[model samples]
Target chain A: MATEEAAGGLAFHPMDQFLVRPLFGGTEIHWYTPTNVTLWMGLTVLAIVFVLVIGSRGRAIVPSRMQSVAELTFGMVHKMLEDITGKDGLKYFPYVMTLFCFIVFANFLGLLPTAFATTSHIAVTAVLAVMVFLGVTILGFVKNGAHFLGLFWVSSAPLALRPVLAVIEIISYFVRPVSHSIRLAGNVMAGHAVIKVFAGFAALAAIAPVSILAITAMYGLEVLVALIQAYVFTILTCVYLKDALHPGH
Target chain B: MATTTQEAAGHAADAANAMLPGTDAHGSAVGMPQLVFETFPNQIFWLLVTLVVIYFVLSRIALPRIGGVLADRAGKISNDIATAEELKLKAKEAEASYLRALADAKAEAGRIIAAARAEIQADLDAATARADAEIAAKTAESEVRINEIRAGALEAVNVVARDTAAEIVAAFGARADAGAIEAAVAARVKG
Candidate 1:
């Protein structure tokens, strides 16, 4: 495979698209610097506004196509929150819904040729996951107080093994944020990278058709992955929030 | 071996530097930029902003509108169902009343027919009674006339017989009184 890659001559820089360069062609990246991430993230926000705000502006009793789409997304996320966390968990619905919409929009927008996938970066996903983690933790303490720690303790287990189980449980509990962020970022990054690799292979005349076919198939799968990842992320947030609301076994 | 490991570490550093933007060292740009520490703050800041914006838009505007439409549709459906039920009940009552009125009309028509038949029968009975009375009167008058005619025929016969008896006595040349002959004829006819 290494020889084949070398023989292919074209060094496919699949990860270069993820580079955070300044939008105006500068090299240095600062906290406030306008970069490709800023542009795509801004575009994601605009796309969300277009769908949620302008799409449902008519508020038609019988929805138009755009209105239906907006309503479908709203209802789907609403139902997910309600089902996973119950009605009590609905207080955090806006946060979870925002996460879902942003992730979904960023993912789908990334599918556009040459568009940046903001959610594909660990920085963005980590921020989202950490915020969820912090919010749920704070809410747990605020709502449940000292009893929230009972989530790590397994009273159902034997007394001798309870402490051992607690340690493992605590580790897993803390690992939630890491897994949450990486799952989304990894899935998005992998799909985009795979497509890029296939596209790079398409430059070869002998394997161009096969590479294009693979790209098309991967793109289709990536579309589903993009939506599902958003769903999985939101549901996980709901689960964490549920734990905070009722932090027992 | 130590020198070789140090050389590898220097090569790795060179590769990392080469991957960084604006570095002169050359390497394949295969590194994931997501690990780049310099861009973390920027991505996090924008993510926070975007999430906050999306949350506000959804909670304040989008969700409410969608909820309103769903609620309005549900309400409309329930109201239409209620109205349909009311109308169905009204239609049932109308049908019942219609049947009741039809029954009443039929009963009234039967009464009218019966009354008309009774009245016609009464008229027929009266006319028959009047015609019988007229026929009985005519029969009585005819009976009286028949008796009178029979009495007149009997008187004529008696007169003829008395006259014939007187003529025969005169022709025979016998000494007989007129009063006595008359008496004899009367006696014979009476007997």
Candidate 2:
């Protein structure tokens, strides 16, 4: 079966080109440039513009339908941030909310059959991670200034071993962004690859009922993974933003 | 050193062959799958732009408008309630004033009627007193004239008695007593 042939890599994989872009003369783009990311960004801009224009037009005390929806979404995100970061965590509301909306929409866009999962790629995930890392780091300095550097040291450790503990803590603190980025990319990529494998198996199977059931089950699981991955990305973002605002905990 | 370099080269070749687009030793090309990172510059640019746009909108426009609408609604409701309360108080005050005016008017009307009745009674009493005094003076004058007429009639009656006594004395062979006859006639008149 072609499915088996493709799975075994005996056949040239069409989707394999969806990786790092090969720069041609430094200016031209490569085949692996993810269109999915562009589509998601376009959709997000449209959504934001639509909400802003329509939701605030009348601004009545009794909210119109659009305004009500806008308010509800805001309240939901605000409450979620408060729950994750506690009451004083409201300062990070804008950052966390933006991250959640962007990631959730991006993940959903990636689930389409022809769409590329940009978040599944290390490059894209790394870019997002770097932004979070930079933001949190800068915020820590802005909020706490010099004291923020103390987060790298376990000051409560025994005086004799405090130096060693501080070094370890600093290394661990530096590792947070890498781990956070890799976890999202790895999970999304692994899930999509597994689903592709299962689908290939069902396509090659001679029996109809068994293969159909297997594909159905895998499809359902893929949907669940999509939702879970989005949630994981959003929750981690909240955690990181919180750390920036309150470094001690 | 030559053997070690050859071994390293061989290892590198093996790793390359395994990553090739062909079946691996396990006959599963899925094994040692090469997941790469390929993000379009345009997409990255757009995504960042979208985020910034959304953040600006949420902070500046939507939230403030929603809050303003709510505050305006609350203020309008409170003002309406306050106005209604004030109007109710004004109505109560007006009703009190109206009732007071009505009572005062009734009291004034009663006083006017009492004064009118007193004036009418005084005028009627004055007219009655004048009529009674005039009637008493006329009666006194009538009684005095009646006394004067009776005295005149008594004198005439005495003269008539003297003439009639003189005729009786000449007709009979005896003289009549005029003074005793006059005294008897006056006593009969008195009785």
Candidate 3:
């Protein structure tokens, strides 16, 4: 590709440097590296802080409209936690609710053209997945001690097959993090890539009109996918958290 | 027939692939390395940090506050309702007592009027009996006085008759027999 073409936004690729690049040498820092994650995380944090500050400011006998909204959101999340985990599930509500809000906002932020979809990268998603995996696992062990290991074998299993059953259970348990991470990453990556490809057609002069329409439709679909992915990720985390808190049941 | 369509799609895909040298149909593998970076570690770190923070905030702050507020609200509402109900019951009892008192007052007033009437009737009956007795005594005395006056008038008439008989006998030159005279005087006296 010519320099002129490059300057004119001619792609080596449309999603070329999704990763952050270092400003000084690679040793110092990279701009494109986790560019989306940083921005999203910042935005999410700011939004949460703003909500909390404004929401809690007017602790009145009767809530102001903003407080009411905050209350409504809290109530909704509380009810959801109560529903999923039963009453005992309430102890973990804050963690689950905050996780939900943060992820949802982060995912929504990625929809912007200039923004990075951090979750689209397997590395980022996998890291998040592993944390949940490890945290829940540790919590389980700490809470139930060696009894948590019994999650592998059905207490009612036939005596002869208990060992074999334990192996399968262990394998399945180990695969949990992998499946969880890949599910989120694959969905986000696939949706974004598909949108990018459709968008590429709009660049060509001959197919501009049809390509624009198709890309527009795909963009709309991608937005829905973004929200769904966020919801799926959050709910799955709740499930894992549940398993950890109470291993068998 | 399905195979034919698949083959046609495959042919179209092949043509497209020929047109674009380095593109996956899914467009995911383009410009990406064969050895993908291991995402496990990074995902684990961020998620763990987020979970811990959220857990702490919820357990320590958010949930406690919300729970407290909800409990407070519930307590206030129940208290208010209980107070209202108690007041209503008190009002009902007070109203019932007021009505009962009114009814008793009316009954007492009625009884008082009845008692007063009985007392007035008794006094009137006593007065009437005394007056009747006094009238009877006066009537008896008047009758005795009338009998005395009648007796006096008859005595006077008797005296006059005796003198008149003696005179008339002397005037007629008739010999006045002593036994006859005596008999006539005795008759007058008896009359």
Candidate 4:
């Protein structure tokens, strides 16, 4: 509640943007609270339906503008999963597509003025990453049995160093979810926080022009980050699916 | 804001900040709202719901339709290309058949012309032979007629000469027989 800057008349509350307040005017935030998270996530769903379902209602061989966009997203995610995991992985195309559309739509929608980024939350991204991690791990085990653990074992390494290499690989495998989740949340949060900081500086007319320029530049970078982070997340998910489908090396 | 409203801005900041998991009594964020552990449950629950909803929507509806559209486009393009190729083959066949018909017609025309020329030459030869035969016959008849007239004229002249000789002998007071006069005239003529 006490920002040192706020007491010093700086009045910069950048982190305030991410607060989880109830949508129906209440201070309490229960697990089922219809908060801004709900609002934005709902909007993300509507946007997806609008583009993917209603946009392609024409089912035109020559697609409309929105249909083209819908097809582009669908094709990109579909190809990424298929390329990484091959044909057998196509069964999980919808799941991968779900992750991609959720993150991408959430990221883009968050860029709007006064929009709360659901993807920017660690809790949200962590859940998504952990779901992919658990699902792939389970799938690997189911498909390959005990051989799934061989993903950590370096078969090419010398026998003496193989165990150590396995240890390293194991650590890296566990770190995937942490890094994956944090990377998306961190990138989004940093860009937004920096923009907020710049906005705070804009109240001072002397450096308002500089602050505005910085915000504009940061906005451009944030937009790029938003799209790139979604791509990164989807690609990583596909990569993990690859490991699950073929848990050899 | 100026220095006077420093405390007031913090109060305003409190108005925006939900005094939830990571906020102090003054109602500003303790650290990052993203790190607050208490709200994780809400965010996670919502995220799960969203993911499930998206999965059903995509798997059930969107993906199949989009895939169908792509498949349909590909099929249509290939089908159209196949049709075009068939049409091209048909055109080529038609052109080849047309050329063959033209060549056949030309050959037939050439044959008819040759036959007509041969027939015309034969008719001309027959007409020329008939005219030559007719001219040969007419010339032979004219020669015979001329020979007959010469003989008749020669006889008349001889008779007149004999009469003239007899009249001259009588006028000279020396009578002469017609036989003698005739014999003399004949002998002089023979000499």
Candidate 5:
């Protein structure tokens, strides 16, 4: 906030854009109240529908550009799902693909100027991670019953150290959802914040060019990070799903 | 040293206000709203709705269409390859049968050639044998005619010699009888 008033007496509120104000101009945000977050999230869904549903409506064998993009995204995620979880994992392909498409769309949409990054918040990511964690855990129990507990037991370790290892394993296991959620939120937040700080520096004539340059560089990196983060999140989900289906050493 | 001291003072101020809920040097409701926790429920609710809608769209519509195109391509390629393999097998069988027929034809041709040569050889042998028989018969007949001519000439010569002998006796005027002259001429010729 000091940086806001540091240059030319103009207050540059970089974090101000992240504020969740009601779209209807009300001060308070109720459960049913629509906010900028809702607008952007809705836009994200519309964007997905446009590209995936309406774009490939013709379903030409030799696809148009939009259809090609849709099929490419579909095949990429399909192959990733198949590769990580094998054929049986394809049963949950739609759910995993939904998570991937949503996160990626939200991330890329956030990259637009003055756009709100819903994925940058812990609340959004925590829900996704917890859902995956709970789903996999329940699946493990259903598929393997009592053997699902074997994931925590260090059967390969020495008998003396097995208990110690189990405790550590259990702690890490519980930490999975926390780490998963925080990793995505932290990376997205850091990139956007860095860009905002650079943009704030752009108010000064002396450093305006340098700040713009830095913002451009950071934007490029953020673009790559957005895609990579989405991929990482999906693949990790697949790995956890694999463990649930087959919970051995 | 002066800059470091001022930085320390700034850090102290930040630490003091950091504990206060949603208030910092940026004033109330001015910090990162992502940390505010007020907007979370709304964001989470929308995210859920969006994700559920996307899942249905993909599973119900988009995925099945793309899957159909892929399966159709795979089916076409495999069918074409299978047809090619079948044609290749047929071509190999035809070539094999052609080679078999050629070999059979060659053997039949050789048999025909050998049979023709043998027949020609037999005809040549019969012709030579017939010509040899004809020459031998002609030579035997010629030898018999020569012997007959020689006997005829020898008889003529004996009669001439007896007539001349009687004429010479008659010129000497001896007056010899026919039976006595003949007996004398025969005894002289015999001697």
Candidate 6:
């Protein structure tokens, strides 16, 4: 460690990798600024179009490779929506599909070298989670009318415990979005930061081999985490949607 | 590790310094870049735009097109199956008619054989009847001829016996009258 510091110090700037810099040279990050966020988000949108729009453009009876992938993604989300929220939930297909496609593409795209993971940011995931939270709550109220409050009211609990259980249920219900957003961002950020930390150790010749091995392993896990996080986020939305539709239990 | 890396990055940035956005004046991240308040607006705006675009693209164009394709494929498959089934029915009908024609031909052959047999049987019966009638008429004629011959032979024998009786009466020398002898012969013949 002493020798490494004496060797003009190790160049360890892991957090700099996440710096949201302007694509065109300027320091001011306005709301409309064309930053790396815009570039990555735009790429994410293009990736979605490639898969969903162009992939299924053939409309072949026997599907092409891209077409089948498109169909598989569509069917998987559709089935999840049906399983959780039943037939009426299919009306929200476009909304649900949008979230799924955006998250999945952003996540996978972020795995590339020097790519910014838009989904790893709290500002981003929180927006999606809060949207889902508000949408579900509103949908619950609209669908079930006054009966939507039954979600927190535990009718099945013993008379003495009902109020206490209701309070707990209310707390947990409100905590959904917080946990939801943090779970994705935290998972993604933690994996990336870990890999970066390992990258820092690669500066020393003695530790380079082991450090690279650790980075490799973490990278593999991150790949899995990327897809799984997308799936987890979308499925959770479906579950919340189900709750909104059927608030009795 | 965080402080050490931050210090090192700080020094490095200082040497070749230009403070990047989302970093401190020393070019190290203030904390986590994710916590940077300034970039939130940029990320949120872009994300909203992306989501809205994706939603519109999918609902308006992608989804409906994919769904239409699926439905079209299904409908086409069923239509093909129906056509195949109709052809199969037609084939079956053709086979049945073929079998019916085969049976009719066999029935016709049987009818022809029966008619031929009946005609042969009738001709054989006619020939047999004609042969039997000819044999019966020949036998009747032969019997009539035999009866006539017998009658003629019986008259000759009667004439010889009358002549012999006359000669015997003359040889006895007490000659009875020829008319008396003839009367005796006639009485004997009558008795």
Interface root mean square deviation of every model, in Å?
Answer: 5.5, 8.2, 11.2, 5.7, 7.9, 5.6
Instruction: Give the per-residue lDDT of model 2 (tens digit) for B1-191.
Output: 34533443454366644222223433343322233111234445655667788777766776566556666877999999999999999999999999999999999999999999999999989988988888888888888888888877777776776667667765896765777666766676568
Collision pairs in model 6: none
Residues A1-249 of candidate 1: C-alpha lDDT, one tens digit per residue: 211244657557677677776788645555677888889988998999999889988878788899899889988988988987789998777778789899999999999989889999998998899989999999999999999999999989999999999999999999999999999999999999899889888888999999999999999999999999999999899899889998877
* By TM-score: ranked, best first: 4, 1, 6, 5, 3, 2
lDDT of 6 at A248: 73
Docking class of 4: acceptable
- DockQ for model 2? 0.14
Model 5, residue A207: distance off in Å is 1.7
Ranking by DockQ: 6, 4, 1, 5, 2, 3
TM-score, each model?
Answer: 0.82, 0.56, 0.67, 0.84, 0.75, 0.78
Model 1, B112-179: lDDT tens digits are: 99999999999999999998998888888888888888778767766776677777876886657878
Query: Largest TM-score belongs to which candidate?
Result: 4
Candidate 2 residues lying further than 4 Å off, grouped into runs, are A1-34, A58-62, A78-97, A107-126, A149-249, B1-35, B38-46, B56-182, B189-191
Alpha-carbon interface RMSD of model 4? 5.7
Residue B38, model 1, lDDT: 61
Which candidate, 3 or 4, has the higher DockQ? 4
Best candidate according to DockQ: 6
| Cα RMSDs, all models | 6.2, 8.8, 10.5, 6.8, 9.0, 6.9
Q: Please list the residue runs of candidate 3 whose C-alpha ends up more than 4 Å from where it truly belongs after superposition.
A: A1-18, A21-34, A84-89, A156-165, A194-231, B1-64, B120-191
Residue B103's C-alpha lDDT in candidate 2? Answer: 100
Q: What DockQ does candidate 3 score?
A: 0.09
Give candidate 3's error at residue A122 in angstroms.
3.2
lDDT of 5 by residue, A68-113 (tens): 8888888898898889778999999889989898999999999999
Q: Of 1 and 4, which scores higher on lDDT?
A: 4
* lDDT tens readout by residue for model 3, B1-191: 34533443454466644211122454323454212232223333444554465456555665566556656777889999999999999999999999999999999999999999999989888888888888888888887777777777666656566566667887898778656765697686787
TM-score of 6: 0.78
